[model samples]
Structure formats: structure tokens, C-alpha cells
Target chain A: MIVWTLLEWLAWGASGLILAWMVADALRVSHDYDEDVLLSSREGEMIMDEPHDAA
Target chain B: MAQAQAVTETKAQPIGLLRVLGPGHVWALGVGIVLVGEYMGWNFSVGKGGALGSLIACWVIGLLYTCVAMIDSEVTSTVAAAGGQYAQAKHIIGPLMAFNVGLYLVMAYTMLEAADALIVGDLVVALAAGTGVEGVDPKPFVILAISLLALLNYRGVLMTLSVNFVITAIAFLAIVVFFLSVEPWNPGAVLHHADLLAGLPYGWLGVVAAFQFGIWYYLGIEGTCQAAEEVRSPARSLPYGTMSGIITLLIAASLTWYVAAGLLPWEYLGQAITPLYDAAQASGSTGLQVFLFIGTLFAASASANGCINDAARAWFSMGRDRYMPIWFGAVHPRYRTPFRSILFLIPIAVSFAFTGLLDQVVTFSILSGLLGYTFMPINMHLFRKRWPLGSIERGYVHPFHPLPAIVLLVLCTATFFATYLGYGVQLLAMMSFYIVASLWFAFHRYKYVRRGDQFTMPWPRPRGY
Candidate 1:
């Protein structure tokens, strides 16, 4: 029973670490450029421009 | 003039969730959860002792993520922003910490993409070989798989989610079938153990070995959190989605291990590349190998696909924040997806796949992840104290007061040490890369980008052309 419990706890702990690793890595790599530039503007004006209608 | 024109056009659109939280976004979240389970099962199953240790490490690491998800949902409910972790960290820990966290996260995700792509490529070759398809180069197939997956995302989030939902369901069913056939009647051998020093170089080293194996099993549980911007009712969906997804993964992993160990001798089990495949074969079902193969392919693809979508979004969010280049945030006019980021991920993944460095990439991912996980427990402690329980309903309190949290923290710290122990110089090399990259970004921002200059335009124009 002790061995079983130890192993069970061990399995949970190990898997948890791997999950944490993937999440951390995913967070690091996936960034978008357009969204950043759009959000960086101080004025709210740029967000509402009509591209097709204006042309 | 082009910049001015672009800005003018940007001001004309109405702010909406349709643009942000599309169907692809939700599918990406599901894919992320499924991938975490698949990676854990595949990579950690290599060496028994190592696999066992990695699982424990993963469990502790997973708890930290759960805490982050809980806090993140509360913040998202209030803010409703696309920045995800970067936004949350900035809100709580300040900008520098948020930037560093986001930076480290991007690095880890990029490597993971490469690693998963390589694994999927290898699996495809093996599967092809089984069917007597000789001399099929893995590189082109890997590129093809990534391209097809990327194209699926390009069609928009709805199509991607529809596909992922089907894949996730099939993968889950396959895991269930694998589990049922094994029938874990003999629980004794599954739980067997020896002295701490037995079969290892040092006594406590055994614990570390177990942790190394166990950690691989728990790799990607937080993929859902990155999609906070895309989920409807992120507060409700995130906590439930993340916790339930993790619990499902845990149950599946434990059962798979228990049943496999019980049904077959460890020596035979350890030798087989796909232990579940062997288990099915022994159970007198010749067709089970085909089932396992198909299941693994879907599982791997779902995970890789989900990571690509979520990680790209994270990049998009960071790019929007000016931590990364603005080009990464570009959404396809028709698809409303971060098309540029997706494109960026494909090349990086292809490069790694061609190199055939799956183990190295996996190890790199684990190291980088541990570095970020160090913040989660601390983030949780801060979150509870600052907001207080009165502000948010404490739905599921972690049992054992501060003890579980403390144990988690200690174990996390020990795992960091163990990572260094197992990897040595390679670990140092990875850490140095993060430190260097972070400092460079900070310097560049300080030197060039103006402080207190808001990057995002608020929704709803203030009346008139």
C-alpha cells in the first residue's frame, strides 16, 4: 500500500512538471505583431478607422 | 503616410469578441489540454524509473498551474483582455516581471513546437514503416503535417475547433479502450518500490530520477490559460476547463501505467516503444495496434495543433504590447486569426524537426518551464492576499492549508535543482539564453519605446469622422 501510494504520488508529481514545462514554453513563443502595435497607441482614434469606406 | 492611413482605417471598426474569441480559439484551448496528456504519456514512458520521477515532478508543477488558472480566471472576468498571462502578471507583479514571464514563455513554447513536430514526424515514419512504406523521408512529412494543421487554422477558428473537438473525443475514447483492456487487477506490482539508493547512483538521487520521469507526464496543462481572451466567460470556462482537463489527464495516465505494469512484465514493457500497443497485442486483439497508432497520431496532432494556435496568440498579445515586433500580431482580414504568428511557428517547428532533436528540445522545454513555474505558487500567494476571498468566491480550496502549497513550492524548487542535476551544463546554457534575451529586450524598450504610452486603442469611437 505504501509503495502504491508513493508511486501514485510520484506519477502525479512528475506529470505535473511536464505540463508546467509545456505551458511555460507555449507562453514564451506565441506573440502577434499587429495586435501589439494596435494596442500601443495612446489615442483611441486608430481603432475605429474605416479602410474600405474611406477609400 | 502608410502608417497614418493604416491608423485611420483601424479607427473605423467596432470592437467585438467575434474578432477575438472565435471558434478556432476555443479549439486551440481544447487541443492544448489534449496535447499535454499525449506528450506526458509518450515522452515519459521511455525509462521506468525516470518516467516515474518525471510524473511526480509534473504533478507538483501541475498544481502550480492550477493556482495560476484560478487567479487568471478572476482577473479575466474583470479585464476581458487578450494579453492573457502577460496582462495578469503585469497587473499583479508589475511590467518587468510580466515582460520576463512572457519572454520566457515564448521561448519555451517555440521549443515545444519544435519538439512536438519532431515527435509527430518520428511517429509518422514508424507508422509508415509498419505499413511497408519504405524510405519515406520524415522531413517532408513533418512539414506537410504542420502545413495542413496551419491551413486548418487559416480557415478560421471555427473550422479548427470543429476538427479539434472531434480529435479530442476520439483520443479520449482511445485512452479509455486502452485502459479497459488492461484491467488493473494486480495493483501490487504497479506500486512496487525499493530502497531510495537502490538501482541509482545516490540514495535521494532516486527521488530526483522519479521526478524527472514524472515531470514529462505533466507537460502542457496551462495551454488553456493562454486562450483567456478567446473563451466565452473566461472566468467560468477557464477554471472548470483547466481543472477538469488536468483531472482527466491524471486519471488516464495513472490507469494506463497501473494496467500496463500489472498486465505485463516490466522488462518487456520497458523495451517496447509503445507499451500500450504491446498491452493491446497481449490482450489477444491484433487490431488494437492499429487503434493505438491512430489514437497516438490524433493525440500528437491535436497537441501540436493546439500549441501552435495558443502560442501564436500569446505571441500576438506580446507583440501588441511591444515586447515583441509588431508584425507578429497581424490578423488575417478574412480569417481573423494571427496569421503571421502561425506562419512564424511553422518555420521554427520545421527547423527543429529536420534536426531530429526531439529529446534535446523536450529537455530544453522542461528546464524553461520549471523557470516559469517558480512564479506560479508565489503568484497564487500574492493573488489570495491582495484580492481577498471576499472579492472572489473560493470555489475549490486546496486541501491541507499552506502545507500542500508549501510542499508544492519545495518540490518545485527541488525539481529545479534536479533539472540542473540531470542536465548540468545544458541547463546553464538555457538559463543564460533567457537572461540575455530578457536584458536585451529591457534595454531596447528603455532606449527606444516611450514609457506610459498606451499601445491599444479603446473600443467605441468618440462620435464623428
Candidate 2:
């Protein structure tokens, strides 16, 4: 019984941590960058080696 | 616009979806999503059509997906967008078609992700039960699985798919290893083929019915195209990577059928939860059983992982075009991933998982995917009509254009009827859901779609226009 309780709480703790991290990161990125630059990437527009697509 | 332009000119950094992926990741994303079907769900075809009937369904529907791969490879080669078929629809058909198609992609994959997480949770319960720890709830595990995968996808595309590649390969190799262990060359030894082999219990209609489940062998391979925007070279990588995925599925399907059918009686094989694992157990080898168990778990995880990636991309694309809230379209500055879209879909997938209606959700997902395939032909015709061969650059051009379209249509229709035969209520439910969704879209968010700025293809002005 004790083991099962621990397992459930562990699962919950891990999931909550991950979700909170993602939310915090999303908030940070939103504040730091301009929206237009964030959305600038287009479909198959940029090649990896040469980054002229955004320009 | 000026700040954007100034920043772009200075750094020229790629904005949306990091473009570090290659064919290997594309193959991983595509196969990883579909491989779970081979691990489970597919055996249900045997339930419907019998073993021989199931094989016929596999071959016939194999041809159906072949056409799907070809169509997707060709169109995706040119369009090279994140939404896969939805992107193609937007480019060629019109806005409404694109909107519905994108919705289909999001809903199908999101539901599938839910289903896979459910499977993982169940498997975890089973694992615990094996250790005499019974009565474990699968819900928390399911939530844990979804949240962790959402984190992986939220961080970056390359790492998400890279992890998928390793696990998917292990899951696939498990099938190979099991096939060899059975010593299929000497079927008389362990297989008992003579006693196990049974003729089709039903008849031709059973074969037709089996076609409904037949898609399991190769479903979701066309998802390769969803990686187009992220691939280093969409033209070269998209076509070949997708093609490689289909060929690999074909081989895997044949081996899976040959081995499982030989080991388990069709009656048991059809209804078994883990057919391959059950087959391994039947082999009476502890090593093989462990291998297959690991394979099943990894296949489910890999599938959930890929589904998150694809669903988020489709939702992100739709959001990018303002068909839904524009906020979902935002990409993470550091990760270059569709962070918001990924976060948004996690709850939706968890909701579906909690529903615990596994068969219903999977059926709905498969039916949605079938509807998406039916649109491929229409998208193809318009694509070719506007820009005939040689009119513009294409990464890869599929040969014998209209025939594959016609083949895909016929097979899809047969499968739809097959689905109707069993899941009649579910079929209607899916259509009604779509109709209601279409009505909701028309009345509500359709206004958000910018009519003028669409048709952003970089090729020559379409010939007729």
C-alpha cells in the first residue's frame, strides 16, 4: 500500500514539474522575443547550412 | 514589419521549427507513429475477417497506403509545409478544405496520442501486476506519459524525433528478433503451421471487413510529410524518407503476419491484446517474451511521441494562418518548436485518454485518417491541374499520376463500407462530428481566416490563374 502511494505521488510530481517548466519557458520566450521574429519561419524556406530564407 | 525585417537581415535566423532534421528523423517520425499498430490493434482484423481474410486485407490495404505514400510524397515534395495533407489542401483546393483537413490531422493524431498513452498505462499496470502489485490505476501513469512527451516535444524537434528513432528501431528489431527466434524457416518445428493454419472462416466479405483493420500495418506513414518544414532539404529528404518508411512497413507487416499467424490460432490471435507478445509467450521462451514486452512499450511511447509532434505542427500551421487563435501559431524563440500548440494539445489528448474508450477512440482516429486520404486525390488533381509536370520545380514527382489517385479512392471507399459494417454508429458519429465542426467553423472562426494572403506558393503563378 505504501509503495503504490509513493508511485502515484512520484508520477504526479514528475508530470507537474515538466508541465510547469514548459509553461514557464513559454512565458519567458514570449517576453524576450518579438512576435514577428518568432513567426518568421516559413515552410521549407530555410536550408540548414545556408540561412537565407529569413533574409 | 520593419523590426522583423531589420532583425532578419542582421541574423537571418530561421524562425519557426528548427531545420536540423534529415531523412533519418523523417523516417523515425513516420514509422514511430505507425509501428504501434503492428504491435497491437491489427490483430483485431483477424477477429473480423479470420487469419487468411486478414492477410488479404493487409495486402489490399497495403496497396491503398502505397498510393497514399506516393501521393503524399509527390505533393509534399512541392508544398513542403508542416501541416502535411492540410498544407497541400490549403495550397491547391481552397480554405474550407484546408481548414477541415487540418482539423482532421489534429484530431486524429491527438486522439491517437491519447490511445497510445492509454496503452502505455495499461502495460504499466500489467508490469506491476506481474510483480504481484495489482489494483494499480493507469490514469496517473497516462498523465505522466503525456506530460513527459509533451516536455520532449516542447523543448525541440530534433531531440524528440531522435529519441523516437532509437525506441522505434528497438521496437522494430524486436519484431525481427522474434521472427528469427521462431525459426520460421522450419515452420514444422515450433510453428505447428499444419495444425494452426486455417482457411478463411468467413468469406470474401470477411476479407473486405478485414480491410478496415488492415490499415494498421501501415497507417500514419504519410505523416512523414509533416516534417517537411523542419527537414534540412524537403525535396530530397521528404520523398525518399517517406518512401523508405513505406517499404520498411511492408516488410515488417509481412513478417509480423507470417510469425503471429503461425504461432497463435486465428481465433486467439484475432482477439489477443498483444498479439506479438502473445506469440512470443507461445514460443515458450522467457527471453523472447521479455523482448516483445519491451517492444510493445517502446512502440506505444514512440507512437505517442510522434503523434504529439505531428498534431502540434498541424495545429500550429492552422493557427499560423489564423484559422484558429493566432496565439497557437507562436513558435518558441529558444526551442524553435511549436511550443504553445504542443502545450495546448496535451490536455486535449489527456481528456481523450481519460475517456478510456480505447477501441472507439482508435476507430475514430482511423476513420478520420481515412477521410484525410480521400482528400489526397482531390488535392492531387488540383495540384497537377494548376501546375503540370515541368511547370515548376518538384523535389520528387510521382509517376502514373491519376491511377494512384483512383486506386486510393476505391480502397478508401471499400474500407469505409467495411468500417460501416461493424462500426456503423461510429461511422455516422464521425461524419456528424465533422458536419457539426464544419458548421461551427463557418459560424465562428471562419472570419479569422485571411482570404487575400493565401496561395503563398513560391512557384510560378499557377498556369490557369
Candidate 3:
């Protein structure tokens, strides 16, 4: 009984720890960087310049 | 103007997601998101038809998915972006199609994630009571599973999927182990295939109806393309990974059917919530039972994890194009994850988990998936019509141009009717929901989109336009 209870609480703690870390990291990144720059990365253009027929 | 654009470009490099994934990660993401179905939910086909009907549905739906793989591999190769089908729709068709497809991907995956977490919670509760530990609350466990997976996704993609790869492989191997343990060749083996066989109770129509549940075997296998932006070589890896994942599923699905059908009666097997575990129980070996229990748990976890990854990517892609809000488009500077979108979706998935309406949640997901497949044929047709071969570069091109597209169209229509047979009300409700969502997008969301930014792939201005 004690073991299962302990396990349940540990699971809750672990969930909280991981979530807190992610939230903190997200905040730190936002604080350090500008939103315009962060949103400007639209990739895939110029990926393949030549249309070589793979026939 | 050029100077301003240059400044943004240079600064954007630091916030860009890393291209660190390979074919293995692609295979893991695709398969991990789907392996749970093999453990449960698929046997419902037997309830609709019979053992033989379910098997036929498996092969026929297998053909449908093969078409899906071919068409997806070709289109996804050219449109290498995070949103998978959503990205392809935007480039090939238009914004309305893109918005619909993005919603389909997000809803399908998020709901599936919820269902997976629900199964995990239910399984934990059931197992605990079986061992004399009653009064366990499943709510906290569901939240814990979703939270931990959301954290993994927020931290990094590579680490998240690498863990998915390991757990998914173990879950897959569990099926293989069951098959080998059965010893199909030995005449005296436990399998009562001869007696358990029930020739199609509902006849051919039953077989047709069973098609809906047959999808459980290979659903979400095309989700590999959701990680296109993070792949090292989108062309080679996406096709290879997706094809390999489907083949693995084909083998696993067959083995699962053979083992479970051989052990249990069709009537009970069809309704059994955990068919594989039930089969293990019938075998009377605690070892196999324990192994299957763990496999079910891991499969659900891996699935939930992959769902978080795919749903966030789809939502993030839409936001980046201003289909939703530009605020959701921002990437984390340190982790390079779509932090805002990931966080935004956590509450939505959690709310879905809290609902605990397993059947409704799963039905909604299946209908959404069918809707997404419905768009693939049109997307493929337009892609080829507008940009014929060699007009623009393609990483991979599906051979027999219109054949796959035509076949996919026919199969998708059939599945819709099949779904209608059992879930008619749900199917109509789902369509109405999308219709309402489409109206909102057309009226409100369409104006926010930056039309100039739609053409992200390096290809010619499509031949017609």
C-alpha cells in the first residue's frame, strides 16, 4: 500500500518537474530573443534549384 | 527593404529547428504513433463481420494504405515542411484546403493522444484492481502521461523520437514473440483455428463494414512526413522511412490477427477491449501476460508521444503562415521547438483526456483521418496537373501517375460508406463540424494569411499560375 502511494506521488512530482523545466526554458528563450527573428525562419525554399528529371 | 530582410534572415538562423533526424527516427515516429492499435481496437472488425471478414478487410484496407504511402511519398518529397499534408495542400491546392487539412491533422492526432492516455489510465486502474489494489484514480495518471510527453516534445525532437523508437520496437517485438510462442506449424499446438473460424456472418457487406475498423492496423503510418523539416534528407528518408514502417505494420498486423483469432472465439474477440492481452491470458502463462501488459503500456505511451509531436507541428505550421495567430509561429531560441504551439495544445489535449469518452474520442479521430485521406487524391491530381514532371524538381515521384491517385480516390470513397454503416451519426456530425470550421477559416482566418509567403518550396511558379 505504501509502495503504490509513493509511486503515485513520484509520478506526479516527475510530471511537474518536467513541465516546470519546459515552461522555464520557454520563458528564458523568449526573454533573450526577439519574436520577429524567431518567426522569420520559413525553410524549404532553394532546397533543390535544378529540376533534374529522375526518369 | 533588402537590408531589413537580410537582418531578419541572419537572426532567424539561431532559432531554426535542427535537421538532425534520419530514416530511423522517421520510421519510429510513423510506427510509434500507430503500434498501439495492433494491441487493441482492431478486433472490432470481427464484431461487424466475422473472423474471415476481418481478415479480408485487413488485406483490402492494406491496399488502400499502400496507395496512401505511394501518393504521400511522392508529394511529401517535394513539399518538405513540418505540417505534412497541410503543407502539401497549401502549395498545391489553396489556403482553404490547407486550413481544412491542418485541422484534420491536429484533431486526428490530439484526439488519438487523448484516447491513448485514456487507455493507459484505464489499463493501470484495471491492472491494479486485478492485483488487489482498488480505489485508484485514473485521472492523475492520464495527466501525468500527457504532461511528461509534452515536456519531452518541448525539450527536443531528436531525444523525443529516439525514445519513441526504442519503446515502439519493444512493443512491436512483443507481437512477434507471441506469434513464435504459438508455434503455428505444430499440429498439437493450442491454436484452435479450425474450430474458432466463423465464415462471414454478415456476408460481403460485413466485410465492407469491417473496413472501418481494419484501418486501426495501419493508421498514422504516413505521419513520418510531419517531421519533414527536421529530416536530414527529406527526399530519401521520408519515402524510405514511411515505406519501411508500412511493411513492418503489415507483418505485425497479420501476426496479431493470426495469434488472437486462433485463441479466442470471434464473437468475444471482436468485443474484447484488450484482445492481445486476453489471448495471452487464455494461454495461461503469467510471463506472456506480463509481457503483453507492458507492451500495451509502452505502445500507448509511444503513441501519445508521437501524437504530441505531429499535432504541434501541424498547428505550428498553420500559425507560421498566419492561418491562426502569428504569436503561435514563434520558435524557441534555445530548443528550437515550436514552444508556443506546443504549450497551446497541451491544455486542449488535457481537456480531451479529461472528457474520458473513449468511444466518441476515437470515432472523431478515425473520421478526421478519413477526411485527410480524402484530400490526398485531389492534392496529387492538382500537383501533377500544375507542375508536370521536370517542370519542377521532385525528390521522389510515384510512378503510374494517375493510377495511384485514381485508386486512392476510389478507396477513400468506399471507406466513407463503410464508416457510415456503423458510425453514421458520428460521420455526419464530424462533416458538419468541419463545414463550420471551414466557414470560420474562410471568413475570419483567411485575411490574416500572408499570400506571398505561401510558396515556400523551391519550385517554378506552377505551370498554370
Deviating ranges (above 4 Å) for candidate 1: A1-55, B1-11, B14-79, B185-204, B267-272, B391-405, B446-465
* Per-residue accuracy of model 3 over B371-420 as CA lDDT, tens digit each: 99989999889989999998877778888879988887898898899999
**Taking the candidates one at a time, how many backbone clashes does each contain?**
88, 0, 0
Model 2 chain B — which ten-residue stretch has the worst lDDT? Answer: B6-15
Candidate 2 residue-wise lDDT, B184-280, digit = tens? 8886898876787688887888889999899888878988989988998888999888999998898889889989998899999988988998899
Which has the higher lDDT value, candidate number 2 or candidate number 3? 2
Better of 1 and 2 by lDDT: 2
Instruction: Please list the C-alpha lDDT of all candidates, in the order they appear.
Output: 0.56, 0.88, 0.87
Candidate 1: how close is chain B to the reference, as a TM-score? 0.82
TM-score of chain A of 1: 0.53
User: What range of 10 consecutive residues in model 3 chain B has the weakest lDDT sum?
Assistant: B6-15
Model 1, B208-250: lDDT tens digits are: 6556445555566566666665555554556566666666666
- TM per candidate comes to 0.76, 0.95, 0.94
Docking class of 2: acceptable
Q: Rank the candidates by TM-score, best first.
A: 2, 3, 1
Query: Among these predicted structures, which one has the highest lDDT?
Result: 2
Task: Provide chain B TM-scores across all predictions.
Answer: 0.82, 0.96, 0.96
Candidate 1 is graded, for docking, as: incorrect
Ranked by lDDT from best down, the candidates are: 2, 3, 1
